[model samples]
Target: MAAETDRPAPEALISAFEPDRLLKQDQSGRRIAILGTIHGKQGILTAERAAFATESPEVLKAFHAAITQVTNLGDNDIYRWYLASSGGTNNVTAAAAAQQPPDLKLNLIWPCTESHIKKYSEQVVRMVTETPEIYHDHVRPYMSAKREEGRLNWVFNILEGRTEQEDVILRDEGHRGGAGVAGEYHYDDAFLMLPDLNWDRKTMGSLHLLALVQRRDIWSLRDLKKKHVPWLKYLRQRLLEGTVKMYPELEKDQLKLYVHYQPTYYHFHIHVVNVMLEAGATQATGKAFGLENIISQLETISGDEEAGMADVSLTYFLGEASELWTNVYGPLKRGEKPQAG
Candidate 1:
């Protein structure tokens, strides 16, 4: 048996089989290997230089001399040497490569600086007060016709005084064979009128006309596009240049115009102006083929008044057109359907 003092320590006993210690020694060897690799790289560089000297002695001599001269110079002196060398004879040409600009990600930060609530409140007030006359004069007549035709559920009027007696009867089932009640209407003063700014009336009217045409089963989308876009484009150009020229007063007012194809309604119409208006001003206005010169043009094209059934008065056309336009372009009220009436 070995003496207690001569016995190997516990750590020494573990060290013989310790994988961790072995791993540490392996890591140390790896570090030495890395250092040796660096040494080898330096050696490779020297060999490469020697090979270059053998292949191109004059170039190698020039490059070596330049490097030696640069190494001896001070930092500032070295910079000046490099600058001079860049412009000097036998210059080492660096190809001019296109430089890409640094990417600057600009996130637009929109701040709610104005009081929208106040602005909207004022708009509502103006719309409620000023829109009635225009609606009554321009939109109500056609809506009244559609209502009489039993093709519209209700025609709202803000222009006329709201009263229970003024309620336009949209459907009369009591009539024999459902004969339409045309031109029978009234107005009420008690009913609350919706603010015009709350809705886009021109878009509403265009959509309304679209829905009406769709329900009537007249005109395909392609036909509407073919017949309408070109005509509207021409009309729009004419109105901007000719009509506006005729009525130069319109130039003072701000104007925005748009034309869109509504598949469901299958008709083309024009939206003009903004929904909101200043005090004593009008809300958004739209002109439909049914309301504009396109009606007469259609009549001429069809060569029959009945074939071009759009020869109604602007007021008459607008009411029905408004409903269709509203259906397509305006926001709907509760329980409103896009279908006719």
Candidate 2:
């Protein structure tokens, strides 16, 4: 446990997101999963917790004494933040051809000044380009497509035989976001809309809009387990039953739902935006994940079986315009030796 570069930092940035602090570590010594999500920042610890969340426990006990005077989450001036793309409500993209991961010496610093690297770019490493491919968010890089017959054949092309209900925004036959019935454990009751809404602008608080679709074609969040915990307990009962049939005054705490580790396309979707925008802020770290921090990392595991979510270890944020991190964390950030995906 000491080896997270010798365990020192966390004096409590919420105890570096507990669940027994997943495995913390990072900065390349690996061990990741500091999962409580929301790394999207505008810093000063998000303006001193929005300036003590409207003050009053005598200014919330001086905001817990200024959050114990922030004990370094790698204090690069409060962990240096930046991400400003406002092309929301309706957008257009394609300026991101920058590719620069060779120098390798980052500690999770994002300077996406004026954004739109498509939902905050963060595919921190992936593989297969020796040919054979498949992906099509209709247009756009759509995570560089590649899959012809096998492997998530587009989740059976949206859960089998299209009846094409005109861009379905919400339907719940029971669970995979709602068309229900997929073996009863790894639900995907379907609630759609992400032919690309990564820069949502249904602007209520800011990041408004939805992206649910789980019908069981497991791919990312390391293909989560414990029988997928009833697809995150049915997206926390649709984020607490805010009755969404196109926002019928929806505001279950401005909705959140999440999951996306290098996801642009590989099926297994769910974004449900707006909790005041920037969930992954133009992405670029281990991609997003927050279904209430993976239902609290599956209510803190039991008998392994993906409930340990691939044994919960972690590390992410590889971007040299990723060809699997220019082929894997640009060769372990240059100490060489990574390749094999």
Candidate 3:
């Protein structure tokens, strides 16, 4: 397949293919995989269809339309769309709905957002400096005072003492000898309030306050509100407009954007939640879905992560799959594509 730039817009391709006209297949609980091979690659198609049939006869019946393109997935691409209804619950709720499903679900496997990252990075820095009391009072006293005295002899003697008493104290206090202390300590409220600073398990339960302090690009609250916040709002608006225009047959509330933040890496991205609608709802009024949650979550994450001490391990939810795609249609605007895809 050719590069993404070489391909027509995804909306155009999706429109031309008429996905609704494609057959729907049920796969009983088997995984529904979409494979993109070279265009006119009969061998690949044959193999894929055979695998599909073998996996579940119900799936073949539900198999929707497949569009072969020279772009999108790759150059000379044969894109296959395997639609199965039984793999998992859609778990998506329209924003306008008064009641949401107890177990509504969405699957969004994508990167974090830039605004989230920038905001969290700034918050983490502020937490370190502004709330030094949380650290100095609760965390700093635990550090070895002897080390601060520059008494090498005492430090050596302490280190050489392989006694059980020293080991117990060190274990309780962390490596620096403060009881109940970890490598990096943070105010619990400060940490919990910000959802944006928390990434996945890759960042939780660790301390890197010193490292964060050394970084010069940590964002400020004002900068985040002025730059990232507005950008996200703009993105949300664009997505809603584009989806409404492109897929008039679909319900407006079906588009969702699931948002998350990654501060350590300094990047932010969005995941889109998509819902398939029946024909009856095609003429219904469009309603924005997931924008409020996205904004709230971003604010909470950013605020919490940035409220504490430096070198603290940030903890926050990794976000569920459905949450990610709740409001993702914004990037699909006709002429608004990012220079870097």
Model 3 misplaced regions, further than 4 Å: 1-72, 75-228, 262-266, 276-291, 297-341
Name the candidate, 1 or 3, with the larger TM-score value: 3
**Against the true structure, whose lDDT is highest?**
2
Tens digit per residue, CA lDDT, model 2, 1-341: 55886654655554343232343332222123433432332212111111125336775565334321111212122122122222221232233312211211123334422222433564543432211111111111322233332434434544443422343455555532334323435343554443222222233344433444545445555556776666567656654464354565666776666776656445666666555444333343456667677767676777755454554554544355745555444565577865533
Q: Of the candidates numbered 1 and 3, which has the greater lDDT value?
A: 3
Instruction: Provide TM-scores for the models.
Output: 0.19, 0.25, 0.25
Cα error, candidate 3, residue 92 (Å): 39
Q: How much lDDT does each candidate structure score?
A: 0.27, 0.44, 0.28
Per-residue lDDT of 290 in model 1: 26
Looking at model 3, residue 125 earns an lDDT score of: 16
- Model 2, residue 119: distance off in Å is 10
Q: Assess candidate 2 and give its TM-score to the true structure.
A: 0.25
Question: Candidate 3 residues 49-74, lDDT tens each?
Answer: 22443357665555423211111111
Summarize candidate 1's per-residue lDDT along 193-254 as a digit string, tens digits.
Answer: 12112222222211110111112223222123223333333334433443234334445134
Worst 10 residues of 2 by lDDT: 131-140
